[model samples]
Target: MNQLKKPVIVAFTIITCLFSFSSCKKDSNNNSVDTDDPASADPTLTLVWSDEFNGSTIDTTKWNFEVNGDGGGNGEAQYYTARSTNAAIKDGKLVITARKENYSGKSYTSARLTTQNKAAYTYGRVEARIQLPTGRGMWPAFWMLSAKTPLEWPHDGEIDIMEAVGYRPDTTFSNIHCTAVGYGDLLPVPDYGRTYHVYATDWTADSLKFYVDDRLIVSYANAHLADATAAYNQWPFNHNFFMILNVAVGGAWGGINGIDDTIFPQAMSVDWVRVYQRK
Candidate 1:
């Protein structure tokens, strides 16, 4: 009887061990995120700056309003307003709304928020989690500009982390704009207006890698910008750059087809903006 009982207990122990091992394997697999970038999972990346938009109001210390309606040289229709109706913080997110209403002689009103003089960084991983607004002429962008004074645009280099046109709901863009390399690639992704997606750029002295949700989409190298004759023309990114977030209506890109007045009061919702640097 004692021998029979010992066999039964050993058999039960073996089954229990196998069950625990299988459960552990399943949990490990489930915890993994679909990503190719090593830094996406690396624990060493330090959060240098971030805005979660937790309060009832936007933190003025971090962002300033680019209040104007001059079309930004793009023939945009929206008059960018500095009022809370156009830009506000609610439900733990920064909401930039574009409305089809007359304001200051413009047919539409929107908001452009910037971190120009308030915050700037030279190189790091800059990203934002955003859900785009939808409409015929809606154009939303999360981009960067040189922090230098006198505001040289393309000469200073522009880094468009994310740009989406409402006419093309299935595509977005990421590009490095300079005199030498001034082109962008259209990336087709799942409908960005339907859900929040992360748009990010990993920038270093030698390269700029664009990513969507940790998946690398395109990479632009600094080899062309390294030429001494074209350094100023191409590599103005050596200095710090500040970020801008805005939604424009009926601009050059968004107005390609024309504005659909029915989609009034469209909004681009930003969950958060984060900047991480190597530790």
Candidate 2:
């Protein structure tokens, strides 16, 4: 367990004078305030979850690269590749890219990475700092799924912590989905695309809170969702879950604007992902 703190947006997003990142600097939101860079940032909370990717290659001990399109929810269009275009680790960041080039019988390519077995958590605050891939027809997500499915999908439960489709530049979606038995909710955050932003989800025994910076966008009260048996009958966010990071192209949710050939090999760089729990 980690220390607990109040959920404040500015404090959670970027504490001034500590290591605040302005998207204009790197032209990509993938970099956080460099620890040794000396740029001052003032944040009250200490580091809990982070991937300062300081190595020459992916950290096999902390993450696993998902290398197949077959597991992409049945409608994902891109074949996952291990190449730099699809995914690569460089300059201390994990970059996930979506491409339109043909490869191995698929017209598009992308990367999906996860911390399925390395780490799993039941609650607290989970955050991922990210800069999105540009152009139309792209879908990127920072999400989680129950590692131990009390029942299969629609039953096991899913937490779409942060998800955005390129066509809607200003609309961000923070949602949850369950079996057809329930009409899950898709909470909206309208400013997710205009710039780099941190998407967060806070969970406790009775509810889940969606946030964009300091704003509490939506709250899912436990009494409103799923049943006790873990069926799609309710919101099932009570179990341990693993994380997933991916940029998908031309899939059912992504292909809306049509693929932009000129933006081939666009990337969604992640600054880091950190989790918290009640101490």
TM-scores for all candidates: the values are: 0.84, 0.77
lDDT of each: 0.77, 0.64
* Segments in model 2 whose C-alpha atoms lie over 4 Å from true places: 1-48, 149-151, 180-194, 224-227, 230-232
Those runs of model 1 whose alpha carbons end farther than 4 Å from true positions after fitting are 1-41, 224-227
List model 1 lDDT by residue over 209-238, tens digit each.
888877777877776544676777767778
- Model 1 residue pairs with clashes: none
* Candidate whose lDDT is highest: 1
Per TM-score, the best of the predicted structures is 1
- Per-residue accuracy of model 2 over 1-279 as CA lDDT, tens digit each: 000101112211343333354322221233345332121122423334556565577777778887876627546678887776677776767788787777777888888888887888888777776778767877788888888844377566677777777776566667665543322234444545444566777788788887765357667667744455544357667678888888877656666557777877788887657675555
